[model samples]
Target chain A: MSGVKKPVERRLRGEAVPALDVARIRADFPILDQQVYGKPLVYLDNAATTQKPRAVIDAVTRYYEHDNSNVHRGVHALSQRATEEYEGVREKVRAFLNARSVRELVFVRGATEAINLVAATFGRMRVREGGEILLTEMEHHSNIVPWQLLAEQTGAVLKVVPITDSGELVMEEFERLLGPRTRLVAVAHLSNALGTINPVRRIIGLAHAQGVPVLLDGAQAAPHIRVDVQDLDCDFYAFSGHKLYGPTGIGVLYGKEKWLEDMPPYQGGGEMIRQVSFKRSTYSDIPAKFEAGTPNIAGAIGLGAAIDYVQAIGLDAIAAHEHSVLEYALAAAEEVPGMRVVGCARAKASILSFVLERIHPHDIGTILDRQGLAVRVGHHCAMPVMEHYCLPATARASFAVYNTREEVDVLMAGIRKVREVFGQ
Target chain B: MNDLRDLYQEVIFDHNRNPRNCYCMKGANRTAEGFNPLCGDRLTLYLKVEDGKIAEASFQGSGCAISTASASLMTEALKGKSLEEAERLFQAFHGRITRDTGGAAPVDLGKLEVLSGVSEFPTRVKCATLAWHTLNAALEDKGEPVTSE
Candidate 1:
């Protein structure tokens, strides 16, 4: 049994260190090789952006090579091919999130632009003076800054739902913050800095009882867990493609068709106008209305390929693999003296953020990089979350499908060296 | 395991362990807070200038090894230097870190040249320069408003 499981153990060690024969999967990514500082690279910063597989890269190349043209208006063969491929991805996203209609899916630059679109358009239309926009303490700056700007532009009041010391959302406080004055609730599905997977479904249900809309920032969640917008009953869901092993410059925003129709167009430009006489121009349909200018044609197709890749691997298997990796990392980190895991919530994705007792996170990151291990060390664009925990910054190591348990052990060794250097 | 000595040279680890001149100057003429929001590095620089020369220079804050070591070296270097000399050093140090002039320019950063390795790590350039930027702000002699880098 031990001999048979040896290969499996190697895969679980997150050791894609260029010597493994994990061919079917390894062949898909071409940029994994090459040297950094004369050592093979160990990229553990997947939460920032995932590397693209050959399928995603090839999909982008194919579109440009065979079917590159403007979409929604062209009558020629290339136009028809591009439009079909672009709209086809919308359906794929709809099925991926289990959204009600293809009309609900709107493509944008990424999750940042998606949040800004809703905050500017829906916020300006529905939010009134003294209306409340409730967000959590663990929100990324993308979620917080847009609401702040919206509140300044409009007369709405912004409220925060606090988090517990363990980094979990305080549901009781969230409920208490909700009332008749609350117009909308925006919260992250999973924290980027901490791996805390929030109870968004319960939070969404509670918000709906009070007749308020909820937007889930799925940038961190969609890549790690299986997301079903219908099951969650969230009013809107936003995620970035780069985080999901797809190309950059493209992401999806899934909103209910009724809510989307009710909201006004975010930007007015070509392909979003029904009739352009320069005198009272009519607007196009929902998704196109939000997608004003030329969309990222190749990026949308690449996202479709990424969805195919995830589905082929089986999300259930991937989630299970990541769970075991997280468990291994947690246990390994515990073995290091003076190292404190920042987010220790029971319900979490595979993000392990921590700090050595006396050593700063930046020092930890620099020392680890010398060992060819990559990890993020900073506030992670979530200042309020850092403030909530009374920490300045935390070193974060996020896991993806390809990561193995062996890599977790390596990370542990690197951290032990940090402790020794700090004399803690 | 690779040699840890290469990345964390004995000099750097020594400075990080026991930083020199790590205190706040009392009754300083100018003070400014420098922050590298990316890594949550915060440092308060205090300077006292008399007769266009630095009478006292001190710092108090928390940051990473590069930043703390850089500040420690800076406080030692600027203690008695004239305002003009300090400005010249700052420019030379900045130019050395950025390596814009093919690194041939003679800034004479002295022991500070040990940090030249930092230029290889693009993300850490901000960390190494945070203290110098703050010191420049505090050393302004003409009642110029203190600013952050």
Candidate 2:
């Protein structure tokens, strides 16, 4: 009972306005100081892409300046240095993911490409014509479209797990969807559009119990929550660097070693092959089999630096701070007349998607932008979710560690302006 | 909020609140659904064509003020015009909204010309033009190609 009380106290205190050193964090991101439309920028689009910190930018610059050479093949000193730095990122990613081996970590262009790799290599190898692929209705287009393409190519049936009105996944229905024919379960660890932190660990366990593999799309979760692939025991996990306060055009895919070894190569090129001949070419092992061409060397190094930055701040601290911001924004947003907060899931990240009555989301975004407040307006690439809610689109204000309660107040005022302008 | 006045002109908000011609024709010759997934704007365009003339036009859907009002304005602009005239109007409206050239000279879009301000907000231009895109799609069977920017 005493332990339970401690958790409850923390949860209650978590809702209180966080004492975030906003000045210090804002100093790290130089982009926050600029003026948009003669107003100081208030960026609330962290879910779309996070702004890069000074450390990440410096890391990228340093990579190009000092370690500018080809990786793995060059014999020169610069090449060796570059190769070590490049491979060192893989090791850092392995630790970040809590993966068993560096061999399990494969770098791709982004989450979309990572999922496509899995769908092409793993899906083609393991999934048969009549096999079933389980997905949820709340998935982003990245998570849904790749599997749909695979299903179309392989003649597999795609089964969708329904979502409740609150945007939580229907676990009972998901269980019913799983059967002997289930070959793979692809799901997002968090819904980018709704801010729902899904029960992926339980979902993975259920899939494994049925002897089916699971792929977790960690694009939205990696930056906000503590993720341990070993603890979750998921077969594959994918995430993008841009969403995690790192550089764009870089992502990582972590697969179980056994599965990685079993799947065939996704792309064919110079680095992915062990030995090449005119007649037959043998592919390299695990990660190299997937990373076929000249990779984003500077991007990878920047991502490694980004991981270091997150580690310095601590994920628990970030999560707690963001949770407080989300709670405050949610409560304050409800105070505005004609404002309805969309995606009211019990377990959510720091995303507030909403609509003002009689006002379109684009109108809300435009009005907010005039106030120097930046928010995303539209379906957010989750069209099915929009269709589900019967909304044309929602205005979303997503927060990161750099955001402050004052910014949330600005967002609230923007909503009031929207109500006033729309005469609601 | 310096130009908050410019962002929400009274005309824009009025059209948004009480959009005209915002309904479906019961026996329209053609209808097409258009969606801008990014902004969650969904529109269904219904047209009544009689003898190569757009006898009636209406739009039914849910979207932000820019899109809904734009749809309402589009229907009003196209009604009672010959198919060729409607196509030319659609082109002029597209250019006016997107800030492109080669529209029907300077002064074609009378009341619809207020939407020329939308070109300044690059993102909302898509919202303003979604209805017109759906209209073009519905008007395809009239055997005239309608181009939208």
Candidate 3:
């Protein structure tokens, strides 16, 4: 469990990494195999961004080294190869999300851009004066702000579904919030600040029953669990590549074909144009219609490689191991006097958001980082959740496929040091 | 990790846990709110100025050890000093913590010199300066909330 010289490469197609072999899995992320402050690095910030596997880094390097060219417009060999690889990733993402067709998958910069795209187009199309857009208090700013912008423009009111003291959403309150004026409902599939896995499927069902479309922000969910957009029946889904062990500047926005067709193009540019004139410019069909620019070609290929890496490891194994680690982390952190775990949803992923008595989360983060344990602090870009608890901020430690119990112990020790510094 | 010791000295921890003047001053004439939104450190500094001198300085807020300690020490340093003298000490103290040593000292920071270690932790510079900026705001009668971005 201490040292793994190499990652396990040869395996049955769907064979999961054994729980005891997390060290071997950790070896694949080269960035994890390092020291900080002369101590072994303990990275617990997976929710913010997961470190890339060798496969993803190699894929990006391979793309740049061998086939570096722009896609969709080139007739040359390099251009054609680049286009194929870039487009190939679209199909891979389609399969990863289990979307109905490649036409449903639109590649954008990241979840932020994807949501903004939908808010600018689908939101503008549907939301109207005095109409409502429903959201939850657990939403990240990315999910909240874009809708706020659209509401400001269209005079649409933004209604928030409150969360319980335990950080879980109030189902009855959600039912109450769902009304005739609700034009759209956007919420997080998994809370990035809290580890609560929302009942998006049921939420989607409720919204669709009211003839209102739903968008699930899967930026935090895509990395942790298996998500099938078709099975969930969400009208739209958004997720980032960086959080899924892929490179930055690439993400996916999955919208139903009908909505994608009805909504105007988010941004007009060369690739998304059917025909271009000063008077009127018709748009391309489906996914291409939403994706306007040249796009993150290398980032798309790298994301494909990341998806392959996760599929090979098996998400079931990842989930089981992460759940155990989170349990251990929660218990260990709670043992410290005055320690309070912020999110206590019965159903949660692998995030431990907590605060020690009289210690600022940023100070805790700084001390933990000194011990080479990276944890996220502050509001986790979900200020509404913090406001709900009347807390200024929280310290968060999130686990991933490659994290081990040993790393969790290191984090616990670092937290103890924080307690000592505060003299608690 | 050894350098962290320099950043979180015993003096800082003691002051952080039991900050001096850690409340709103009664009959305070000048007051301003300071916020470091990135790290969620927020403080309100109150100054009682009499004859252009700070008769009292107090604060109320929540922040990291460095920030709480800095604000605590800043209140101690600012009390009984004239407005111009307080501003001069602010410059010297700011220079010491920020490692901008080129500025000549108008007044010795004394106990505030413990914060000299903060310069090494570039991210913490804002934490140490939040109080001073708020004091600056209070002195100028600027009611706008001071933000150390």
Candidate 4:
């Protein structure tokens, strides 16, 4: 554990007071101020789902407390208030991503559904038989399975861009794979398992040069780094709100306005129809046409509160504090005897995945759990990455804004104990 | 972490470190593969049964210590037992880990009793029984893969 702290201290350079007060930030997340397994909870499973801050929780509670009504169709005051707040989130997301317009942002269940919306609709509408859908091996199953389903339905081929042993994408290989048969290139902006931040801006530019569209699975990126969909100029981007410390059952799919207008609606229901007759029906508009049913009104409003909360703390400050934790945790984890860190990409983010010698990750996870260190120990919905590394699974520790350097020490101590019990 | 110590007993650790009957039996007539996709635990359970009686038992795979040790102990106890006896032993061993027999082994299970502490860890019950499940599949002569879903 001392080895872990030394590297972090070197990185910190004697600055005890970080730019963002993590202790003050920890207070906002009430769930953090509790105990698990008779020990103080050291939650490091942010990549799976983050704990909601008080503001996001209060926003949901306040909705049920006062503004409990449906949106977009009612004449009553409660309905109007609910409608305004719900739609207000769209504008907030629009600004958050620096998207061109609110018409481009559509809310869905999550990143999985958002990808499926594009697959089922845009994929079903435009993807030709024998066309190729190129993806990297590091993408989550949510990103991979949708395209595979699309391939099965359309007889289109699914091509993959291989990753280096260090978990970074091979740019030359990606460029070579993008040929005439390639219709779309879909890739993750940041790997959930490896923490490898792909050169998405460069990848998007390469795809655009070939007149191909691209979709960035921003599930792991949106929470940890700055995302400018406009600057990147991606045709489509998807992310979930629950991972961003908001509510579940809510996410955003930002598509270029032209693409959304050109593609057909995903689902058909009351809200999406402009008019309906026995003979024919006409769709309403881009976003409403996509979000057909009565949406999770409370979830969307709560997501709006989350965006406001993150903005107040600022993404830059949150990222800086998390980066410190990452560097410190890395130095500590490397000190574990025979410890093998899975992903060592040159540029990474708030995740650290590793395995101890002679110890299965499941045992390691169980031992860590007994010490109240919550980590995700599985394929992480990215099984190909595991297969690529010839591993069944790896233990992952992902940090967030509220995490402190001390928590990393606790994690290292717990890992050392794992070795002690195993006698390794 | 007393529970951790109890779960990873010295005998279990010894067996995991040097598993007994860890091989594919050459004259084995029955074989089955077991897989726990979630944990990436896969093993091939081989049995040599002649005239409805067990002749030999062995297994090969990779998994956590609890699972590896469980398979090691299971194969050792299963040798020289008749088919009916093997079935009865499986019931007793499984019941011990699952705590279905009022938290006590109904019969003397010998070395297999060390794994009784596994019942406390609900998530690891499948790991302890994965080899046994594969053994059941081999005895049935289904020759298909088994899953710990």
Interface RMSD for each of the candidates: 2.1, 1.8, 1.3, 0.8
Where does candidate 1 stray beyond 4 Å? A1-23, A420-424, B1-7, B100-105, B141-149
Each prediction's total of clashing residue pairs, residues at least 3 apart in sequence or on different chains, is 7, 6, 0, 1
**Fnat scores for every prediction:** 0.86, 1.00, 0.75, 0.71
lDDT of 2 by residue, A373-410 (tens): 99998888888888789887888999998999789988
Per-residue lDDT for B1-149 in model 1, tens only? 23444335667767777888778878888788888777788888888889999888888888888888888888888889999999988888887777764445566788887777777767778888888888877765334433223
lDDT of 2 by residue, B1-149 (tens): 53555545677677777888888789999788887766667778888999998889888888777887788888888889988887777788888777776654655788787577777788778888888877777767544323233
> Mind sharing the TM-score for model 2?
0.93
Lowest summed lDDT window (length 10), candidate 1 chain A: A15-24
TM-score of chain A of each: 0.93, 0.96, 0.95, 0.96
Candidate 2: residue A69 lDDT (0-100): 88
Pairs that collide in candidate 3 are none
Better of 3 and 4 by DockQ: 4
Candidate 4: list runs displaced more than 4 Å: A1-18, B101-107
Give the candidate number with the greatest lDDT: 4
User: Candidate 2: deviation at residue A350, Å?
Assistant: 1.5
Candidate 1: residue A49 lDDT (0-100): 90
List the candidates' TM-scores in order. 0.92, 0.93, 0.95, 0.95
TM-score of chain B of 2: 0.87
- The numbered model that scores best in DockQ is 4
